[model samples]
Target: MTRVRGTPSPSAPARDDVTSLLRHASLTRFLIARVGSITAQQMLMLAISWHMYDLTSSAWDLGLVGLFQFIPGLATTLLAGHCADRMHRGRMVAICLAAQAVTAALLVVSTATHSVTREVLLGLSLVLGAIRPFQMAGQQALLPMLVPPSLLARSMALSTVVQQISVIAGPALGGVLFAISVVTVYLTSAALFCMSAVMYAFVRYDYIPSPREPVTAESILAGLRFIWRNPLLLGGISLDLFAVLFGGATALLPVYAKEILHVGPQGLGLLRSAPAAGALCVGLILSRRAIGSGVGKKLLIAVAVYGISIAGFGLSRWFPASLLLLAISGGADTISVIVRQTLVQLETPDRMRGRVAAVNTLFIGASNQLGEFESGVTASALGVVGSVVLGGCATILVSLMWSRLFKPLATRDALR
Candidate 1:
């Protein structure tokens, strides 16, 4: 892992420490809504997946849940980014949450009436698919408004902490609630989404609305053009796309659990959470002592470390060693993620943030979804262990190649 340079410089303005940043009411409220909505959304998805599998025991039908969600998101995300820039972003966020809440509420009614089916669930997944791109664009673009520029890095770190915790907790909470009753889980998620929506409505921030640009192909493609023109942004964003696209080690946890480790479903659950747990720990540390100088080098090194960690895991036979390797990989990833996000957000102008964030979000989504598919196909051809090891090596090589290709990203000393 890359070493932390030091604590916040005493001479720096805005008192950019975790406690001071968290003291801001607007930032606090945004975080609360972010965690709430994300958790509820994860729980909602978990319940829906289980519901679909319970109804139809076919693996193909179970797979349609992701396919349904991805198709709509791919189609509408660019448009959603435009909407984020042209509208009250907070209101866009609120509307998205409300829409999700309505979907969950409908599920509760459908489940009660015994009318819920796989088709119904998939259709609702499509609705979620359409709404999330807007929600994500709004949320990313709004955070810069809630804090001073000096504090933005720490704020991003802290936000990552909340996000990792929510990702870990959401599914566990939903699983427990689901064991009691499916409808009960859906009801709770709906209430949480409603709470999140109301909180976002009350949250206030300073935003200078951009003058409405006439809709054109150029307007829609502005984000892409901007990223292409900027080496730093292109390197940071593409690094994630390729690194995650290759280093999808976790997607094969089931094989490790059943065949290699001799553990069952319970162990798979523990294995799945290890990455988030590691990420949460690192995020907490970064929240206080944010990464300082040598930002670009650290970012590259972190990706290399992550790839190495994945390779290490591919060879581990013991459960404890496997868990540690996975944790290390997650921690390394957290470093790269914070650095990339800070650079992307700080370097981009406010007017272009929505569009930039949309492209960023698109790459993130595509990497995750396709990364699993890549893993699956490779596992079939090369065998699971061989696939994972080769992928990790490829990730390391990519990091090396990126250093030469994006010298500005690799040689930079500060995010600002």
Candidate 2:
């Protein structure tokens, strides 16, 4: 049968893909909780970083905050992953969020009582860090259950957008509140976490228990083996791991605000928020459009762009120029994130998602916290600008090397 000359195709309705995904009740509730909890976490991070720097005025101390948080996460990765696969994910997440809320509340009380100390902050970081992996692994595994397989990419993209939005708003709000009173920032964060817990309680999804396997070294090692066996997954995770490890500039933002940029707390907030704003914009675009073919090449190109932008930011003295560069870097990074996360989730089985996600979390923790520690140490030796510029250059080199090393990843044509 011949088609009409001006007739639209069957795929015309697909233009509203993101809206369709959001219509799922479970997914919608999850997104709301994700946004609120993530925003509060971001806000708390800024407040803690600022407080630490104000207390010690040392880059090493700033780095130590990340290190402190990371140690607990590292120590708990395997066990957390195993638990997520077997446990009630919603309840697990709710409990973790409640713990965080309590931590924030403690901070509020400490600040109000004139008893806030670096030791207390570090201790709280350790607690939160320990709980974070389980929370993340459960959430990652739970996501697939909320939507059909066809909508998985869109769901991930939308979830990322919510996270980016939180990143944008959280720090800005924190900065303003922090300027008024540290206690106010802590109290606000605690309230937000409580709100997120309530939302998590309302999310409804059918849980499927994975095949029972005795908890042992061999069972725990399965996730690592799976990632190792899949070259594409290995490459994607390592690329992100190395790129962020070398290119991270966040740890030194306070230095830029005080010594180099000469902008105070508000300016620091802008600096921190710039990247997330950029990521949010990109996430919105990707939610409407697919990445299409040549996924591997696109990921590599985005990472290289991220490195170049980061280096540009490092060298820029003007605040506006720096913000623009960081935004560019953030946008580029968002592309890579979407690609990597899609690859991991689509490739892994539901039963194994938690463990695989846990491994992914380890890479993330290393790239972020360990990277911050690296940045701090290097900054102490090379100065802030020099360290950032060098790290960015290293990131560019990593993208180039990884492209040649992981041929499968470079040659990948589709996410699935």
Instruction: TM-score each candidate.
Output: 0.86, 0.95
lDDT of each: 0.81, 0.87
Error of 1 at 415 (Å): 1.8
Off by over 4 Å in 2: 1-15
Candidate 2: deviation at residue 183, Å? 0.6
> Candidate 1 lDDT, tens digit per residue, 26-114?
88888999889978986787677657756874334544665576678887788777877888788889999999999999999999999
Highest lDDT among the candidates is held by which one? 2
- Span of ten consecutive residues with least summed lDDT in model 2: 1-10
What are the runs in model 1 whose C-alpha is more than 4 Å off? 1-12, 48-64, 106-122, 249-269, 314-319, 376-390
Model 2: lDDT equals 0.87
lDDT per residue (tens digit) for residues 293-379 in model 2: 999999999999999999999999999999999999999999999999989988998778889988998889889988999999999
lDDT of 1 at 373: 56
